[model samples]
Target: MNNNLHIITADTVREILDQYPLELYEIIKNSYILHDQQGSINAPSSFLFFPHRPESRIIALPAAIKPNQEKFNEISGIKWIASYPNNKLKHMPRASAIIILNHPDTGFPMVCMEGSLISATRTALSGIVGAEYLYNKDKSCKSLGLVGNGFIAKHIVKYLFLLGWKIENIHLYDKFSSSVEDFRQYIQSFGDLKITIHDSVSTLIESCSLIAFTTTEKIPYLNDHNLFKHKPCILHISLRDISPDIILDSINVVDDSEHILAANTSVHLAYERNKKDASFITATIGQVVQQKQTIPKNKTIVYSPMGLGILDLSVSQFVYDKVKKQDLKNIENFFPS
Candidate 1:
């Protein structure tokens, strides 16, 4: 284990984004490994045991490789992150977290850093990658239907702007009224964009060419009757926020089929429990980006990413490397040695 540890914070992440190219190559690659790798673990609600409830969730995600790969075992302590949604506090973020990068063999602590930014950026990068493959830029993409208004949602919208997507029309819907309003004010500084708060899920999703579902709901969001009939819509299922019937109808593109099915979110698990086949899935997102297959024309495509550790590790690594280079002479010392 490396003892020369480095920590990064939300401010550091914003600084990194200003110069990090926001490139999707490494993000997309690590996302595939995280989705395909079997040993990765995720328990989203482990923090229910905590006394103070701030809309928090805990995740202990780890990944290891068997000896067969190189006649030796290797594991990584990529992250043990806690996401607490309390950004409303003055000078505080919606999600606050720390990640410990440890030695695979000795189990020694290596680096601990602010993970809220890492988590948020990696999540948004997944959506950006999905958009790159799922949506047709030539067809005049307009208006984005964002389902959840959390930290991750904000990054998704930010990346949409980065891709030259016009946000003249943004429809926001969340379970909490204040949360929706919070997002509206939070994003107003990005650009001149029209924002509307939708009272119903149907109202938010309708008539939008590009849609993103990033909620924490266990079940699908849209009902059977309200399914999108409009072909060629890009559906970025950041979380399991689509109905089983919708999953059944659309050309499903997963980051990894095995990982997504294993996570057992919504219809992905339902289809498995009943022994139903998933032959309709067009292709994995990696395959599409790698040119293994092309997204179908005039079809409602869905890209569901089962947030993976490799993605977390990759982003964390980026933050770590960048922070190490700083002289520590210019910024506040938020992360202690």
Candidate 2:
């Protein structure tokens, strides 16, 4: 074993990504394209469930990037992340994680870094890029609704502002008013539009052509198909928010078919309900980005990405190289000879 392992803290990840949101967006785009070309290998994300604590789960996402991607080094890694829905009540984040990058050839673990920031950042940028291919700005940006105002929603909103997406208003619908207050103040720093907090998801759904679901719902609670009758563009950031029937009715696009199909997500439910008929999902974000597949203009478009592991690896590669040059802390003799 011949490798030194570097440790990247959340503050470091935040500091670096805050300065370069657009660059990270580009990295995610390239990664999707690389994935679309089949230049990457993404294994199914395995989960550690606490049956006693049904609301919490720890997920392990392992993936690799091939040398074909010119912008990033050929590397492989896994992000181990835990999500506890009640953590916010304890005044802590709901999700926490760390990513480990391995030497692509030697298979030595080269870096261990805080992953919650990277996970959220990559997740946000992926949603933005995924929606970029689907939504017509004039049509979809009517109000920009958010279902959950947790950390994920905050990152998505921040990138939307920093990346220069024009918006006239932002309508929010969250279970807790306390959650909205902090999110509302955060929006002020980025400049403001009409910030309305609707009393219900249905009202918010009716008000915006573009809506993002960022909740921690494990099961399908919103089964109302009529809510999306306006044919809105929904960035289903939280995978299991919509009901299976809704998934069946809408035109869906996921990051990867194999990955999302098995996760018991809405689409997965639809897939099972319809007896393995996956015609409802029109394309992966990769195919959409490559212009190989096109989505119809007059239907509800649900871009439900199950948070591909390959994405984490790609962004981790970029972050590792950037911070590797800086004087960050590292674990010496990490790989024993």
Candidate 3:
């Protein structure tokens, strides 16, 4: 079999997002198997950490096997996607990653691809998927309140726009006014989107039917108003962005309970600290989309994505294939033995 490595850039991802739908679905499908490992430190000032360090790495490890052979043809592959944001300010990129595609049989490296866009797009599409399953297609949703304006928020807005969700009103509240203003200008380039700067998060949450918490905040700074009960909204809690009380009050759906619980990062930590059972997790977003389970419309639904490796691998696989077709490459050898 012909083997080669590929290097994919941020622009490559934009092209992928622009053209391929089937490949996108495949990536989302495979992402289900990977896991998330967000954690924290007790050091001075305290910090949240998602070390792609060792063990618990959810390697996609894809392969092909011969029918009658005792051993199968194996390929080497490992994907690592991780991120950390301290405050809503400082212009921090949410996630950075390195995806290793290798020869499994020979234990040699194959290719390396840029994972930032893959990570961002896969994550943003998740929110789109959430909107698909949770909200009725006929329902009119014009106003959206985004709690934090960060890297992830940009993509979420993009997907929402792509889905034909004529976002007539955009409400934003970030700790830094500059970030929020910058995001508004970036998204405004898409079209004549009505943008409103919320002096307070509470005002924004109350005004819009849909809400997204794409912040690095440790807790929800909003009032007691449970907006989830009002309409089918998305709480895309990337970090510990919302409060434990909010989590308990809302309908909790996640990418993977096992992965989230294992990592004990973000909202998962709140549940872990409160000694909540994993069974309490209402549903996995895929299962809901696939109709494995049903969630009530009356409840506020929050989808916590752990940013699994399968997502990185799935998108990286696409980049690898695209690079091969164009004859662009990054060489990494497998089976050094």
Candidate 4:
């Protein structure tokens, strides 16, 4: 194993991604394909919870994406990520993470990268990718409804631009009006979309052809069955906002059914409510991508990826390659060999 250890900062990671955004999306999509081909090892995430603050958690997600026909190099890593909602009260970012990529052959740590941005970027791209595949119709959306206007929503909107998604209108809703205005201003910089801030979540849901839930809800609150009457493709990114009845009534596709159906997610709750029956979940996003599963007619389709770690490792590998090409410094002998 190479003894050289490299440390990449968040600014560098973000800068590299901003320059080559399409590459990030392609790698993530390819990672999904890798997992689908049975060429990946995705272990269930281990959550570290605090007794004093139940809302906060640190998750260790470890995965490996093996070499595939997509020319994706083998990558293995773990993302040590923490989400502390209380951090917001202290004016800190609610989530912070670090990804460690190990050498595929030797299993030695090769790179340690700031992972919050990587996490957010992969999440944004993966959701859109699955949204496109699960969507039976055209790729271009008329209007996208954002249920929560936060950091992930910001990343989603940015990637939409990067990938040239021709969304003519954007309807947004947030529990807090301050965040609504803040996100409105942030999106207005894009110039060209009709921005509508809805006082009601249902109005936003009813208004758009595409909808994304990016909230931090720990429980199922939105039980309205009428929200999907328009048959919009829902990007259930936050995972727990929709109710069991809604989930059962919808056409759901997930990155991995087993991983997502655990952890008491809305789908998990649905499984529990229905005596652990998971037939309601139609297919994995890979099945949708490979056209193995037919996306049917006139039902609300939901794409919820359980945040795969292989994608993190893939993106980190991308960043590592770019950093090397640019001749960034790696601290030799940092491992005390």
Candidate 5:
């Protein structure tokens, strides 16, 4: 057995990603294309719900990608992630995770790394990739709206800046005032982007051309289709925030139909409401990215990405490759020989 396993800490992952931000859009783009080409195996994530605290749950995602023309190395990994919405009261992050990568040929564990940053970054990049194809790039969207002011929302804003989206205003709405204020202070470091705190979701929805939902709602909440005045491109990052009627009224896109439809998400609710019909989902993001489906221009485009494990593997592999070239310390004796 090869004794070359490396343990990557959360601080290391954070430092590497912060220092050398890769072209995540492209990395995620290739991953989606690989997914569309049937070059990847992604098992549906297994969820362990807390009986005492019903809103909190842990999820295990396992996936592998076969080597193809675009990517030469075979990669297989799994991410164990947990989300506790009430963790914010204790001033801790809501989500915590770890990813494990194994040698594709030998099945020996090769790398184990912190995965919360990977999770957030990959999820944010997914939103940006979807927005790239679905939103009208020719038209200038000055205002962006964020429905939740949390860790995932912060990463999404970071990626939006990295992608060079010209936003003149940011409208933020959060249940907690402190969360909104903290997020506001964080974004101020980037530039003098106008940031407004909205009193209600309806106001924020009406104010921005691009809206992202990053809350921890397990059930449907945002249902009013009439509030969307701009035919906004909605990034449904948190899957279950928007109601079924809103889904039916829009042009819906998802990362994977099967995965997103399984967890009582807005799409799943819509499917159940319509008597097990899936016509509400217009196309997968891969199909849109590959130009297999025509992007509609006149309707609200809702993108719901189920947070695939392939993305976690891709980013983890990239970080591992980059970190190997650096002078960083890793856990040498993660396992006994």
Candidate 6:
């Protein structure tokens, strides 16, 4: 197998991931634990912004998870992903990506797999894990609000069900009415859930106990602190959606404080507004997951995950391992020496 490497396609990646939804959650959870324990080298993502089209960007995330004697072998990889918000208007996906994994022992590239699915799946899992840790799971969430009706929102809904969240109501709001309608119909197929489409963001925000913002907004738009009542759980998945005032008023949590603070995210903005003080960032998800930090329940909780590269590595490695076991026939030779 020295001369051969596998080139996994998007369809295969989706198939494998769909087959083991719970396993994907566990993989992401363990990866977060490993990340908290400092078992991984997570480099900051490099951004390539378009000057002409300022909304579009391509990011390079390089990461490596240290070897574990019992669980995972040493692995290093990079995910090169691009985001073009206008692609939706052109009737295409907003993001596309590929991951290249290097051999641990020899530093030779061993796998090249389609990474968009991995990216979405891992991201969705991260949000769910944050909710699992930060949200009051014992208390039932009757209404779920999705601020953006996009691919990431859809995946979040999918994994929420996979994780057995008994959400009876789903409130969806999008700038585009067509996207909201499509999302409403898609979630309706799941059955036993009430779906409502809202024309305004504030209306949707007020309707749900668990709210998720998955839009492409680069700056803070939701600034009103009083809009958040009843100590709801906010999944700040899109990073920059919430204003710093809201972040300051809420109990803040993050995937990584340092990484998330660098990208001008809502958390980053909060840091900036507060004279670069980081006391507002209460704890990382790893700390919460490990029970090292306790998130107070009296205030609204905002989880801002910067979308770690280590997570991409974990999910990509999982896909590679699964493909090797079940679909050997699809393997391709990268260097046929």
The numbered model that scores best in TM-score is 2
The best candidate in terms of lDDT: 6
How do all models score by TM-score?
0.78, 0.97, 0.77, 0.95, 0.95, 0.96
> Candidate 6, which segments miss by more than 4 Å at Cα?
328-337
lDDT for position 53 in model 2: 95
What are the clash counts of all predictions, listed in order?
Answer: 2, 0, 7, 0, 0, 0
Root-mean-square deviation of every model:
5.3, 1.5, 6.9, 1.6, 1.6, 1.7
Give the lDDT of residue 21 in candidate 6: 91
Task: Give the alpha carbon lDDT tens digit for every residue of 226-337 in model 1.
Answer: 4477754555555567666667777778766655665447547546644767676678776777677887755577778776666676666566667768843223343354
Better of 2 and 4 by TM-score: 2
Better of 1 and 5 by lDDT: 5
Better of 3 and 5 by TM-score: 5
lDDT of 6 at 65: 86
Tell me which of candidates 2 and 6 scores higher on TM-score.
Answer: 2
Off by over 4 Å in 4: 67-70
Which ranges of candidate 5 are over 4 A from the true structure? 138-140, 327-337
lDDT per residue for candidate 6 within 25-142, as digits (tens), equals: 9888888889888899999999999889999999999999888734566899999999999998899999999999999988778888999899999999999998888886553578
Which pairs of residues clash in candidate 2, taking residues 3 or more apart in a chain or in different chains? none
**For candidate 5, what is the lDDT?**
0.87
What C-alpha lDDT do the candidate models reach, one value each? 0.64, 0.87, 0.62, 0.87, 0.87, 0.88
lDDT of 2 by residue, 1-337 (tens): 5557788898888888888888899889888888888888898899898889999999999998888566767888899999998898899989999999988788888889999999999999988986678986332365899999989999998888788788888998899898888888887778656899888999999999888999988888888878889999999999899999988988999998888887678889989999998888899998998889988977899999998888898888778778878996878887666
Give the TM-score (vs. native) of candidate 3: 0.77
The residue pairs that clash in candidate 3, if any, are: 75-103, 75-104, 76-102, 76-103, 76-104, 108-334, 220-243
Candidate 5 lDDT, tens digit per residue, 261-330? 8889999999999899998899999998899999776898899999889999988888888888876465
Model 3 lDDT, residue 267, Cα? 59
